[model samples]
Target chain A: MTTQDTTYLDQLEAEAIHILREVAGQFEKPALLFSGGKDSITLVRLAEKAFRPGKFPFPLVHIDTGHNFPETISYRDKMIERLGEKLIVGYVQDSIDQGKVIEQTGKNASRNALQTVTLLDTIAANKFDACIGGARRDEEKARAKERIFSVRDEFGQWDPKRQRPELWNVYNGKIHKGENVRVFPISNWTELDVWNYIRREKIELPTIYFAHQRDVITRNGQLMAAADFLNIDEHDRIEHKNVRFRTVGDMTCTAAVESDAFLIDDIIEEIRSSKISERGARMDDKVSEAAMEDRKKGGYF
Target chain B: MDLLKFFTAGSVDDGKSTLIGRLLYDSESILADQLEALQQSNRKNDDGTIDLAILTDGLKAEREQGITIDVAYKYFQTDKRKFIIADTPGHIQYTRNMVTGASNSNLAIILVDARNGVVEQTIRHSFIVSLLELKHVVVCINKMDMVDYSEQTFNDIHKAYSEIATKLHLNEVTYIPVSALKGDNVVNVSGNMPWYTGKSLLDHLETIEVNEDEKSPQARMPVQWVIRPQTDELHDYRGYAGRVSSGSFHVNDKVTVLPSGVRSEISRIETFGQDQAEIHSGMSVTLHLKDNIDISRGDILVNSSHEPIVSQLIEADLCWMDTRPLDDSMMYLIQHNSKQTKCKIREILHKVNINTLDKIPADSFQLNDIGRIVIKTADPLAFDLYHENKQNGGAILIDSRTNLTVGALMFRASVE
Candidate 1:
């Protein structure tokens, strides 16, 4: 890559790398929030760059929904093994069994919101003072207000009004005992940047990210795959289509996009020309305008 | 996309939140659920007109009063640039919040009501923007539609603001008239303003090259943490972990660790699991030294030839953020980079009259006041003039008992 072309991306990468090191240096216990998505996967690569030749400075924590695509889980396991980093799984299913959370009853109910509880519980139990996430600001409105070192109160609530003034490269990670900061190293990156970085780095990802034939049904003008958690009525028809996921979340809510781009170069071209946003096909955010904000304030990653 | 960090300043009725909400809405950055919440909140109000500002001013009290209470950061990106927008409140009482927002910004967007034309708050915001040394400033005369899109009115407002702009002596200044409520000259070029030939706000934002000062002649790397295990696999290992604050460092560079006045040579710049050829500001890496020196957290490293001033006495520009007035005789926790030491306030030189851009001589600094002050730290901290090196010349003052960050201090000059 030419130096000029990668200047902006390199600057962003450098800033992210700085924040990652800060998390390791400032906090007593820190973890990388891994979701097997492209953004988090990109974060994993940056983390590797931040601390390599040795094991990761922090462990990888995944808040499992118990409804993930098997391909994603397999990819997650393989990535952890390849990097030789410790993985800690916090299960929403266990939370449900313990009555910490109640599963919603509906045709398209998701555990996406419920994961917030499990995530907070994990942080409190593990005494993690900082959790570095893969969230990008271009994804949502509420996320746009997030600080690189976002402070959460004792109740795991985000008070946007009183966040510390983050100036220059100096991030003040000072917080009270029970309060923790949600560190987002890639806060300035966009979806296209993530894809471009992946392409340049030749990072490995789940096979579901590429085009493949899968049985899916059209819902809400978006195509969703057939899965165990997804309920299909008798009249609901499923068709085989060449599709790929623009984003990977819980299986019930994330919709696949119609595409034939199997390679990274082709995917980059498709993204450049695509009119719809990355979150357009995701069924979860479509529930309401402030769904992400509400979830975020309640400690959702 | 290139990254641009900016701050927006406007009063309650200047439509700051609406402008941000419109940008997000027109760009399709708002999620489906967030749009639903906006609708639901509007429905609950029983008014057909959707309060677009609710998209940004999310607090319940802010919704009730229709004013921003504090600084809120918002992000959005176009084909060319990614933006980190710090939306600060307009109320006079929240000027400290505005200072906090503008401190880290490379650019500032100061919104003025077209009909009002450079009111008291406009001058106040512009003064603070200038004080912060923000290179680029865009003066957006909003609500032009309310004035029938008159070119004469726009010129009058622009002329009035130019006088203040001259007093501030900013690096670069541009004026644009628009109707934030009607979406003119924000994301797209407005057809109504035919007399204006300049680029739209988004166009300007996309092309403006932000001069991020990462390269400096005097290098500073404040040690944040020390990595020392001396494990069986890796014996005789001592690395200083910190982000490069300024300048560049190469292997075998003669460096001196501060606070202890110990000297050493750089053996390696470790990052990404491998030794790097060189390292610059904003890159966090571990430094291996040729000679093992006694260095720990709160110690700074610098070039031996170009040494920074090591003194306990300092004169600095202070932005007091706490509600309580700073105690002149009390010792405050002075934190510069990762170095924390006790510093007692020697005296207050002068306080800034933000509305007039005048320095009023004062004996003490109060809440939300910008002033010049003298401080004496317990230990000598290596630093330069704030205008020369932002990394070494700045620090934060915290109350010893409360541990609350009270003021941000930048070295004005050395106390000779």
Candidate 2:
């Protein structure tokens, strides 16, 4: 093989593709959790690589929070149609209406924590034994301790202290009835790695990732995108500026970073020299230092 | 960038958390607001000191006691590489937790207090690390300030650790002296000890080789899942989905499905829409067989000419992970490679005391004890010696009642 052909990226790409196939091979019923984010989008591309020219062995499921960027919604719909793959969505609004969950109310209330209810309900409803996610450990503290085939109690809660020991590349995905495993094929990939892969592969993403003019206001020291779900007071004083989201989540919770990088390469360069973490722009994590951990234990993806 | 995974084993007071906190802090990895909160929390405690360890030990009890009680993970990156650090507790009872943390790690950082020299816990941790067969080990003599930057002290600790290292089989051992509380020899080389010449902890980590065993002798791929596309575009496409456990495979390679012992030629190796010439360990790929093979999950695909031993009676090295002692008559699930079958403990040959590395005859195995056992599976299993190939030789014992993984096991030395 040529020197350039033996790169680590090539190795990682091959590994992820293998895992995507394994999920299809192992479980009785399995599905991919598509969030319309870059990580999941990369997963979609990997899925296509694993099983293309043929429908995916398993359907793609998205736990939809009614409060999402319109661009993401449009992009998600277009991708599903383009791929001609089945798209299953579980809505948080439905769960709330069904009294399965009650929306949080506060100055920074968001559907971030409530997504767990909808996600678990969807899993139980579909009887999916494995729900493949794009969650990378480098993204958060609690997620760093997760196993690739993380076993969840029948209740869908993750016990950080009691995780099964995963050695070498052997993943034990065994579980009893009513139990499920949350598999993360890209668990080893970092945010920078994700951006670099996106640039190298030229993967398409939502427009919100690139720098654009948006009406946003400063709240809790973060630039909150002005959306209908957000309770923006008259005194908040919205201003048009060039900003892009570091991450996509419940529209009310995710914040934007001021940047001028509009292209993938430029964004990669920006991330290289950037000082703050990718999740720094997300307001939801600011609820508390252990906010993500708390949400994950309660079954949040 | 190179992907590196490492584990940190040190006492709660050995400044492990602080060392990790420094890496996160100096790399500009933490958010500005999070740093602000950390500073605020430091002030809230108002102990007149910066508790950098708080950044890693993020549990309620840990925060209250100012110590790590469980294995916590942290990730950071430099321009050269990306690192995943498994910050494990140093307490003896948390030994099981340490094993969980080190199982996936490519290297281990065993921190020692320079002033205390090599303590019992240090040797215990090192022995466990060697027993786990981790390729790279870095012995960090921490708390250099406590010894007033004495090279003699650093050398003394290093010399003591070298003897301990000789007792166990280890490869690629390096030593560094640092003061985690003072942020020395962590992200930057320490100027206080100009006499010491070596790369900083991060530098050695950035350049260390990982998965060197990827090119080892045995080739194994345990089938994780099977994909069959019965659609119109691809009506008769069937592929075996799995990660290459060890070695590599290419298109047209003659392979066999284990247990079933069905021979087939690799028609194609596909990932996404692209077809690759070959695939290796750590890479996930799907294989298409030339013939119709009735294969499913829990099956292994091996080179037909280089098949593994398929046997019903075998010996295995077992690490009991359950509270309930292992019973010879009890039937448990043996998950070896990708295959799962009913099995019973035929006999307990002996148990190895992890502390002294000595074996004693025993009728049963208990929690956290390593022992040799003979087991008989209902179905023949494909396995290689654990010393020969970790991927194919190792397996987990699952309880029938709670379905909990009760033990981590390995292939035992054959008496034949």
Q: How would you encode candidate 2's per-residue C-alpha lDDT over A1-301 as one tens digit per residue?
A: 3122345566667667766766775688999999988999989988887776557888999888999899999999999999999999999999999999898886677888788889999999999999999998777766766778888889998887677766555566778899899999888787877888888788889999999999998887889899877877777879899999988888888889899999988888888777677777777777677887887887877
Q: Which ten residues in a row have the lowest lDDT in candidate 2 chain B?
A: B42-51
Candidate 1 local lDDT, A113-150, one digit each (tens): 88989999999999999999998867765676677889
* Poorly placed runs, candidate 1 (over 4 Å): A1-6, A218-221, A233-235, B17-66, B69-82, B145-155, B181-203, B206-209, B212-215, B225-241, B269-277, B324-331, B358-367, B399-404
Give per-model TM-scores. Answer: 0.88, 0.93
Compared with the true structure, what per-residue lDDT tens digits does model 2 show for residues B237-354?
Answer: 8877777888878778889888899898899877655578787766667788899979988889988767888888888877787778887888999888667889988888898766
lDDT of 1 by residue, B1-416 (tens): 55788989999889898888777777776665557657777433224566667877745456667787766667667778778788889888888788878887889999999889889889999988876778899989899988998999989988888888888887688888877777899888899999999988888888998755555778778887667655687677777877777787888999988877889989988875567767876667788899867888788888787778888999999988887788887888888888778999888889988877788998777888888898999888888777777778888888866556788888877786
Best candidate per TM-score, number?
A: 2
What does the interface RMSD come to for each candidate?
3.8, 2.9
lDDT of 2 at B98: 81
Worst 10 residues of 2 chain A by lDDT: A1-10
